[model samples]
Target: MENSTQINTEKINFSLEDLEQDIWVRLVTGAVKSRNPFHTPCVATMDKGEISLRTVVLRKALAKERELRFHTDIRSPKWKELSLNPSISALFYDAGDRIQLRVKGKAVLHYKNDLTAEAWKNTTSSSRRCYLTLHSPSSFAEIPTSGLSEEIEQENFTLAESEMGYSNFGIVSIQVHSIDWLWLNHAGHRRAFFDYTDGSFQWMIP
Candidate 1:
């Protein structure tokens, strides 16, 4: 549910420019508000001739640069897959607002770099705990486990202890190329496409 501070930006009278700005507004909101539907988006990538999809938290959105950022474990398959094929897509939807956004881009990984260093410095110990795993994300286990060590699983590690996970932490920056936006309503639906690569935008039949 939207908070009291949320404004009504999905009205039918909205223009293309308004819709584009609203999309960024919602993305920025999702990054800070866990309750927002856009907080988690379905990210798709090409992996060895196959399509891989996963839900990722929206860490940052830069409207001017046409980029979206996410954090990941350097050992994760998604990281390696993206390294092999940078082509990626992201899907976001808000049922309450009846809006959908399909974003296409290329993924750029940052590991042990200044970008990752700054991001790690601002990360909380709890969030950093995700990188303290004993095995890779999809590694097979003899028994069910959280992939994290008992100490990390129990959240007994101190802030300094969490620093060990920083090496496994990495950033995935999506250099957005285009966006397909759709709005559903009882009266009628609206759709539009915006391409940053060529600076082309147009309304489409919904």
Candidate 2:
């Protein structure tokens, strides 16, 4: 049996403006509900003149501000990379929709600030446990582990336990500069570029 079902593109047709709205709505809803794979995007940044990429869960999407939000451990290498160079790109794909969105933006890190506090307040205890690791992310160790100690096991985890992770929790807010949208179909692929800096939206050759 086929593992996936293909989307029929024949019934899908929209103007650039409509498509943009659709994309934003889908992204915002996906992030809020964590309902689709688009909720996790491949975020790319520059580290020591080299490109670094990682998948991050989307925490928020502000369509009006053209911004995307994600949380990370402050000790992660990506946090350091973003601190050194805020310019970043995120790629999101919806296989069911045959849509791909590439977002270019500048990231602003929030730590021990109002933004971080608010984000933490909204975070679930289970989710917050990720930041409770004793070692920094990607750290070398003799044995493999989740980095969380036995004392922090899931069964007894609580919101109070998350306080220990506050120092390591950080939020990344990306101010979107541009978005390249592509839709693939058996008939033809459609591509469009949206530049928020210049308020330009134009079709591009796929």
Candidate 3:
């Protein structure tokens, strides 16, 4: 039989073949989220001369495009910090799998009629619920949380959308500069780093 650890890694698309063909499944299906060791993104930023970190989701990744994306409210604190500084790092951990992907890149925000809107149009309604909240992100509010039910009376699907409420949608696209992927298998532990620059990739071990 194949080494179980190796098989598991492949199952998670940590292997070459999986990475090439199944990365989209790993992201869109939310399959990788549960399989992941880290429950959230360790997004690092500089806040007024001080370093800060927060948990965010991986959002979306287009394997073919070699791009990773995340969503946020324009009014959110992270948004302001990101606007001030475009360079950012996204850290991911998978506790059960002992796998991690640390991504460093220049984050570019997307707004209506630009790259961001195109991304927003692709998001699932479940994810879009976040943009419907009554209050702006990071805003002070009353004690109770009413959830999306109150604001979005109902949800209907469509192939096309309008400007009605799409303005609230914000997408963050990180043009990946480097991805440091590490894994702790049952027997063999390995770390590999890949850097993408100027339409080329450089792979190295660490």
Highest-lDDT candidate: 1
Task: Give the per-residue lDDT digits (tens) of candidate 3, residues 38-101.
Answer: 4357788777887778877776676666667777877678888888988888786656556677
Candidate 3 has what TM-score?
0.68
Better of 1 and 2 by TM-score: 1
> Which of candidates 1 and 2 is the stronger one according to lDDT?
1
Best by TM-score: 1
Off by over 4 Å in 2: 1-13
Model 1 regions lying over 4 Å from their true place: 1-11
* lDDT sort, best first: 1, 2, 3
Steric clashes per prediction? 0, 0, 4
For candidate 1, list the clashing residue pairs, or say none.
none
What is the Cα-based TM-score of model 1? 0.93
Give the local distance difference test score of model 2: 0.86
Q: Worst 10-residue stretch by lDDT in candidate 2?
A: 1-10
Compared with the true structure, what per-residue lDDT tens digits does model 1 show for residues 1-206? Answer: 14522336445676678678778878878777888888899999888899989999999988888889999998999999999999999999998888899999999999999999999999987898889987877889999989888888888989999999998999999999999998887888889999888988889998
Residue pairs in candidate 3 whose N, alpha carbon or C atoms collide under 3 angstroms = 37-94, 37-95, 38-93, 38-94
Model 3 misplacement above 4 A = 1-40, 122-126, 146-164, 186-188, 198-206
**lDDT of all the models against the reference?**
0.87, 0.86, 0.63
